[model samples]
Target: MAPGTAERIARLIAPLRVKPGSRVDLARDFDPRYKGPLKKKDSAELLAVGVTLLAEYQQRLAAQDTYGVLLCLQALDAGGKDGTIRHVMSGVNPQGVKVSSFKVPSAEELGHDYLWRYAARLPARGDIAIFNRSHYEEVLVVRVHAEVLDRQRLPGDVRTADIWERRYREINAWERYLTDNGFRVVKVFLNLSKEEQRTRFMKRIDLPERNWKFSAADVRERRHWDEYQIAFSEMLSATSTKWAPWYVVPADRKWFARICTAAVLAHTLTGIDPQYPTVSDKARKDLLTARRELEAEAPKGAAADPYAARHRSAGG
Candidate 1:
């Protein structure tokens, strides 16, 4: 029922989820390359099933118009976040889904609280919003680089040494509030290995079409890989609450990662179990009246049902 192939796949990847209040040591706790029994060959089929299920659930979610889903994807450069989003969500109606990629904050964004921009882009009722890089960036990148924090322009008194801890508490509380108010939060951390990251960087440079995706800034950021890892571990440990636990997807293999991410989403939507709105007695009566009027408008002695002749002609 999850981002996995079937119930079996979902159970297989359950260990990837970070439990509440559990300490995360990315290097020690999770394997960036672990795929369990799943192979690359099965990814397409598994992903296809997941996508179809997602489309059905998405339609129900929209028709019900009762809840919104927010999928927060946090990853380092070359972590396959973009690819995962593209492939996993390919089947959903474009209008029912939104993909927001958060980059370096603009002057206007910096002027407001770090979460201000994110809060504005939250999913509306009955839709899904995917945050490529989310509010967690404040804890990940900002904590990694002290200068980034200074740029936030917080009051001096608010910039205590325990700012990260305080922010973690604030974020947890904010997410809790969102859950209480009908938005379900699904957080995923794409755990890409450093070696694989280097390989991807080389491929981006080696392929002419992908050269534009490569950036000097990406290389600079790679230098702080260890720092980012530490930041990610801490963030996962502190913020993986019962309401919105983190799914640490093994991201070294793009296909596997996509499958896991899709399964996670499918699983969440399953838990939500959104249903189509039931027609009330009054509405049903009105529908019957409308059907009669439409039938009466047909030509005299002609079939009131447009498809009736077609079905007879086709020997249906």
Candidate 2:
């Protein structure tokens, strides 16, 4: 990557990152509709470039088979998490990428620890895994609806005071462990404004094609918008560690959000600096020998002349 390009992308991403140990008030610290310093057209162009770069980087990462990348996306309804995944990751090789969309846990999933369902979905070395929603839901949604926790059947002491804080600490430690094991966790929160969410919901109702996306339950959850916001703010503040920080991306502008996501992904992969593995000296020698053998077997001049050979063989 060119220095200028790297610097430009870094600038675009810097403000969005929730610094570790800093409190973040979503309303005060981020604008859900922000498009940064670029015009729409410029941003789109940069995003295209970023997509290409991401694909290249992913190829290198896969070929190296040394590190894994995990992208966890969190957002409220109509927040564009699906769109971001579709567009931003469109350029990557499917074989090298795995996407997991977490919905309501099944009986089997609930039987295990909250993170158990997610652990199996994590990327292996040289692959990228995306979580449409993740373990954070244990804190965000489960916190918003405390009753949901009652079913977990945890020890009485584990459910007592400071449980949320304890979860945050656990998450931080878990992410640090992943980093130590060569997995880079990129956490993205698509910050959508309530007004924009309302507009999107209205669109879902008005457009027949999008009608299926509209759910009465989503509207019910909208009533807890303030609670969700507080939950998100606290979550961001607590878990945005240096090893696995959170990027609070603006989602009102889908194009800009996609661009920002691609940029952040590109930056993270570049930071990992994956490279194609070097061939061993013996392998190199064997490759050269194989090349020479294939070269020696190349078709002779008359065999290569297909038209002439056909005529000669036919006695023409």
Computed on alpha carbons, the lDDT of every model, listed in order, comes to: 0.92, 0.91
TM-score of 1: 0.94
Would you list the clashing residue pairs of candidate 1? 2-263, 2-267, 3-262, 3-263, 3-264, 4-263
Residue-wise lDDT of candidate 2 within 144-247, one digit each (tens)?
99788887778897898899999999999999999999999999999999999999999999999999999999999999999999999999999999999999
RMSD of each: 2.4, 5.5
The C-alpha stretches of model 1 lying farther than 4 A from their native spots are 1-6, 299-303, 307-316
How well does each candidate superpose onto the true structure, as a TM-score?
0.94, 0.94
> What tens digits encode model 1's per-residue C-alpha lDDT throughout 1-316?
3443457656966988999999999999999999988988888998898899999999999999999999999999999998899999999999999999998899999999889999999999999999999999999999989999989999999999999999999999999999999999999999999999999999999999999999999999999998998999999999999999899999998998999899899888988989999999999999999989988999998888778777997995
